[model samples]
Target chain A: MDNKVHLITEQDIHAYIDGELSGERKAAVEVFLAERDLPLERAARYLRNNFDLKAVRDEVYRDEKLKSEIDRLLARRKPRRHLIGASA
Target chain B: MTNQANTISTEDLNACLPALYRFAYTLTRNDDRASDLVQDCVERCLRKQHLFDGQNLRSWMFTVCRRVFLNQIRRDKVRGVAVDMEDAPQSKLSISAFQEEKMHYQDVVESFRELPHNDKVVLSLVAIEGLKYEEAAELLEVPVGTVRSRLSRARSRLRDLLENSGEEGTVVAASV
Candidate 1:
């Protein structure tokens, strides 16, 4: 060990895992975890959570009927131009 | 479509459909309502396309979806409907494999959907939507600190669920 004490908190770990840490802070966090032999499992778990969530959401989007309806809505003509173009 | 080049196009709307529907489903927790919310959100996005900065369409769409859901809840409240509760009838939230995918994915989805509403909201915004804490706070109208706490709690709960279901932590890690 280099005999250096680094202050790492719960929030720091989360931020680190979330990819929100700045370069310097992340390097510091890396050293802190390295000293303690941490495997960055938290980051992996969170990424897996995200991947799982994506897989689930993709399935939700697979409803072809619903997808068609949304596409139809998007294809509809824009609302009538204001009172200026009224032809009764 | 109007002559304004700034207007949201059919292509743009189509590209965002999946993400918008996913977020809408997260909000409503029901197929019909989620679809309605998404349609309503797209309609609003069309009408208000002029207001869009055209920088981040995904973020803008999410903001509008959140607003539309809240507005719908408010309208329900005015109509004497309880806006404070999830529609208990749909609480079961069946995730039957309507697709060719295996049953394992459905189980994972159910585990995700069974979390508390706030937990789901936090997770969807941060994990699924890929928004930063500040952006999620902007969307949720809460402080960044609140998003952080909810994220932490949501992830912890999700881990517990995965572990209980034998979702394979090391396997997930390797895949991710």
Candidate 2:
């Protein structure tokens, strides 16, 4: 095992968690994180927080009222096939 | 009829409605405005159907939605309509009993609302919508690096807000 301590910056940690780092740099981040407890915990918490926020935001898309309203609007438009058939 | 050849099918348009509405809601943060934006986008798509390729319909719709939102922002700026708390619609998520996770989620949503519009847009596209960095960059008309940087800043700010808010213990009582 190499005795040298790898310095992991906050951005490096964020990128590492985000899966943006690659190859040797990624390997280095993994090694560094394995040796540290606090940073690893912090990265895990950040990821969890991101997932939680995403989950909450996803609720907006499930609004049945909005979906029905949009459906009503689209239903009003004449379908292209119908128009083509009409013209024929 | 002139644009009939390139028109999106009603089924296809309906399939993407939820995603389109979600993106609009994130950007506008107002239910009424988001509904209007989606309606306007669907109308424009029908009128300019000749411009749309059959594939990539989702991305095309997202690009159009973003453009419409930006244009509206520009118009609002010109008209000096400052978007403030008073302009914000009612809270869509009702906070019930003070469960820990619910409180945390509520704090997250409140902090998310406080982010700058650009930050919110970037974060929503990449994080909430699960768009790739390159895709978000393309939609936002910025380089990939800019998206990364913006996401980084947004995440950091959100973390700060969450931490500080937790310390402040500003959790409101459940409406029920």
Could you give candidate 1's per-residue lDDT for residues A1-88 as a string of tens digits? Answer: 2455568765666666566677557656654533332233454345445655754665533545533543443344244346233312
Tens digits of lDDT, candidate 1, B107-151: 667677667767876676666555667666766678999988888
Q: Rate the local accuracy (lDDT) of all candidates.
A: 0.60, 0.61
* Error at A19, model 2, angstroms: 2.7
Model 2: DockQ vs. true structure: 0.08
Candidate 1 RMSD to the correct structure: 18.7
Cα lDDT tens digits for candidate 2, B12-105: 8898778777666555544556688899888888788788755456656765775676576666545433323333223222223223335566
Docking class of 1: incorrect
Off by over 4 Å in 2: A1-8, A58-88, B1-98, B167-176
